[model samples]
Target: MRKVLESLQRGAHAGLVLDRFGPLAPTDEKNLPERKDRHLTAVLEAAGSGATRELYALAFERRRSTSDPELSRSFQRSVDGAMVIGLGIASTLEAGLRLHQTYGVPFVPGSSIKGLAAHWCHRVLGDDRGGEHREAPLWRKEGDYHRFLFGTTEACGAIVFEDAWPIPNSIAGANGGLRREVMTPHHLDWQGGKGAPTDFDSPTPVGFLSMVGRYDFRITWNGPPAESATIAGWLDRAAEIVSCALVDWGIGAKTSSGFGRMVEAETGNRANAIATVAVAPVGNRADKRSSGTPARVTLVAARPKGGFDVQEEGRALGTLTLGTSPAGLSPEIGMTVDVQVHNDDPVKPQYKWPVASKPAKSVPPSKRR
Candidate 1:
């Protein structure tokens, strides 16, 4: 147990354990050279069979004014996903104006940032055109996965958040809640403000005005696979969903007009972030066939909202083998995913509570209920 945790700590500061299988030996004489090989073997044997519980968490940021319809609509329609935008009447319009001009635009309306993130999701989902229903579900009732089981080439997914910010003014108002100076682009009325002219005369405020905008996407899934093929299948679908969300904001695909970055403070690395898929197995009902290991399936975790459709049961998230083997653990296993981003933005800390431990062993399958 310490070895496994050590290996994971080498890479990430925080981590969560996903679908699990039993038969892993407690530290003891039962440990053998064959033990590692045996464990790997068990994991590989389970490919494409099915297992239990899939989850995901995705987050993004927006800058918009309080009155934008897009912000409200995005949240109202975001039954599965949530969005938050920055909006604050700059403590001083002159300060806000200086910041706006620095971004190479006449104004940095909060709505524009909000639209950028929505568009980002749209691009990720590959649905920029917005014609088809890409079937990204929060979770589906089980049997659907088996319907296309053996020959199934397509996969489904979903996205969600707890809040939606469709405009810049909204963020400005919220900012004061933190008791900081409120400043945003939209609050500046260039056509008729104190400046008389909209363009910048100097760069001081412009530099300070360049506030950092942020977006976050997190997902929990059910597998670690040996190939990118399956992961791609999931990613392609996820990208499509993000695209649709952006389109709703009137942002089009491949447009410089709609752009922003994905920040993962969890790691200092800042590149366009991609999916970080993890795996865990469900409770027993093991081994589809009497093989050295039980057949395992690979599954990615995602929110239950958004429109991506997926089945709740029998979806081959990848298989689970009771024992472990390195070779067949799936090439996709033990890999790190980095999000695409730029800028060294500071992060705010949030409150959290400590958790208690649980009993290690499972009761017999017969007594699961």
Candidate 2:
């Protein structure tokens, strides 16, 4: 157990066990192997399987937030595979990065998501702290819907908010991965309206903090049932309102500069890719490599003992076994290699190429100045 924690801290792909896996025994890095490396945060063997499979195992355990993907799946319609962007970084790390204890995957707590939903609900109804009064049941009286639904100092809310998890390999755009962003707090010396901006009040640049990409959300519908419509209608309306709220107001730490805004993710392409991988008997896009098709793939992580994962063109092409490459080359995270599958092996064909390679220069030789 100590060895595994040591592996996690010391840049080893021990596949950091999630909190549900069991309590992580205490360990110190002092006795572990001396390897000064900052490893890329990723998941274990089951990272990119069906979302349902992963969520069922991870949903209810040791989560800090209400963003559970498993709970969200129960609802019908477009909210499935929906995204909730950076909810904020409240962490022990100096830079304040939060991750799933087991998979090292970043996420937004379901509690925060619930807050977003409630905020959205209130905003749409024009009851956002307006100090307006109305009647019973739907309109509010003692032991009314709001109190019953959201709870009070004496009771807990009926709704069960679930922790949100990122869809594996759902990083959008070219450099789809965790990003470090800088936050600066200016005029920290002034308290209230007591002080004015001066030369002494230099801008303080907080260290670059890590933030994750878009994520999927799931919130259970154990709260109050709609007085007027079916549960489905209630959920649909709530989903629509909250989705808009996320985009308009955003969530988490820095909203003025736009930090936690999110929208539904269109995962069709990824879905197709996963399906292709499951059904394909032999041929695939990676087939071009046999014909000497050279493409750039980012190596996410490599096991100190053996294999590593390859993400080509913003998509994970599965882990490739690090066979005997020319010269003894060790694997490193964030290394790019030009590669393609050399042959059609029945069992997920392992591609052959240099452990690392450079991108072919786009400019034609004649066009180069």
Candidate 3:
């Protein structure tokens, strides 16, 4: 990992198209001195890349699409309902060493969400048997409803918990957005070695990560043929537990030092935020999907931030996240590229296209370049 970061730094120096930069949290605790500074700087630099920004923008757009009132209605068969749960991670939140492998963005994993849910359910809900039953086999071939909902070794759960991510435009640092944080751990030798450098040991700064922002957390229900009333009740209880767990119990690393504590965003609570959308039924759902049919499009503009504006004929279409087009698309404004409409929210619509045919022999290499 260190080698990878070093290579990217070299690429940036050589004017190469460096992939996005992100704070790659260090795993070796011994080398703690420069971890914080290096991480924050790298992430800021990476986030500035047009390619990186484009990915975030597109992701945000897709998220918005899922939440759109009218558009979401189309997927009524495959989807159950969705809730926008917002959370604020305290400055001390240590998301560990993981970042989105592709985007480099920090996120709370779905596993953590599952854990948070289970913790709230068994502990807060006052399960008399306690978490001890967690290991016990549900054993029923039909599966325990609670076990089926949350999942156990015997079966997968009915719900899909997505990673909680930073909302697009929300990761910005300067204008009251994300703030870099410092973690200084004292008595490193004792802590690091489990003995040794005692009170006399020097303290070291661990890392600096962005702590600001109320991230959106989305949960989707993919189900069994349960009664609507039963499913609705379960969803209600689950959302409540998750909300309480995040606020009351907190999340991520370092809650005791005041890290990972977050409150719900003002938009709405789970009950109001919840929206039912049917998952498109199996048959002609593919026909209804935008990607099923591809259309040829022309490039209108190359966004400075690593994406291209597209048009079909003279009509404006939308933005294509960088690298979505083939190298043949070139930097020219009028180049044609085949594309498929990407499903989007009522807000911003976009499309993605296959790599263009090899650059025409008539075009100069410089033009292609």
Candidate 4:
């Protein structure tokens, strides 16, 4: 997901093509305006006319008291439905992310959409009784829904590509994970002159990601419309919960890896402003006491005299005074600290994390994940 953001920022059209169910009706784009940003382009490319019914049935319906032929047909429908849903989700998220980024914000990532969908399946199956364990179980038996449903994870969990036949303008990772590659205005015949490019030259810049989630579950019905409506209402509630989970976990792709912000106010350039962070041992008190015997340890900020401030929850911890030199400065308290430094002018934010690199061996083993 971090790599996806980098790809977009570099001007690549990150394509997320979903393969699941049958085709859907053509969309009415006549009223839709031509989008200029990379994000919108990606969404348009992701649009699919399929339903997810087939994939869902194949993965969940074999357990029913239906015959193989009937279930097989249902499974096919589920596949078509899943594919269509996947494409629609991809398109919607692509557009939403582009809009957020254009406004200098972030939206969730497509990978998150997949993860949420997968989890939803896990939950529905896991909670069901009279079936094998709902959690993903290996060695699924033939005709077992568990085997069919969980079996697709290997195909759907990660985006992959085929060399023989590829997307018209798809981007590929070194190991060939399909990256976000959408169409661009330059490639649109409606805007560009003759010989206009038909594909993306680079991935789009991701400002933020918009998290999109959908879930499908069966509801018992004795043939009453009111019961059906009740089921619909329950699904809505589930959707809301899924949205909350995505936001809480930071599980969705929303911003550049190292540059994501907990609080994103439209302040001017902030890079020029110094950054200071309060570091305190948290979690178990016993663990904190055993590791740290020192009364205090020095904390550092990015700049001198930028007036870095610290806070915990909403209370003011204290001001961080940087000395004339770049040497470490001792903190005043023991509480966990959050530092803030902002200026009137917009500045490119700098990060302590490397832009691109894995854990270095220079660090101790305990520090390495």
Best by lDDT: 3
Q: What's each prediction's clash count? A: 100, 18, 12, 60
Residue range 168-226, candidate 1, lDDT tens digits: 22222222111112213442545446555436543221211222222222222233332
Evaluate all candidate structures by whole-model CA lDDT and list the values in order.
0.26, 0.43, 0.48, 0.26
By lDDT: ranked, best first: 3, 2, 1, 4
Worst 10 residues of 3 by lDDT: 71-80
Please give, for residues 1-369, the per-residue lDDT of candidate 3 as tens digits: 676765555221101121233334567766454554555555555444435656666876787577633111111000011111222322222433334555655556778887776755554343324444331222122223244457656345556666776665655544222345556778866765688765666666554444446566656664443334434444544555566666665676556666665555663333322122111111112223355247555554455457765544322234677335555435465566666767531223466665455754698778886
Q: What ranges in model 3 sit over 4 Å off?
A: 1-39, 48-51, 67-96, 127-145, 175-178, 192-197, 267-369
lDDT of 4 by residue, 152-184 (tens): 422221111111111111112121211233333
Q: Write the per-residue lDDT of candidate 2 for residues 106-126, one digit (tens) a residue.
A: 566777767776655444433
For model 2, the superposed segments whose C-alpha errors exceed 4 Å read 1-9, 12-94, 128-145, 172-176, 188-196, 223-229, 267-369
Q: Rank the candidates by TM-score, best first.
A: 3, 2, 1, 4
Q: After superposition, how far is residue 318 of candidate 1 from its true place, in Å?
A: 18
- Residue 243's C-alpha lDDT in candidate 1? 30
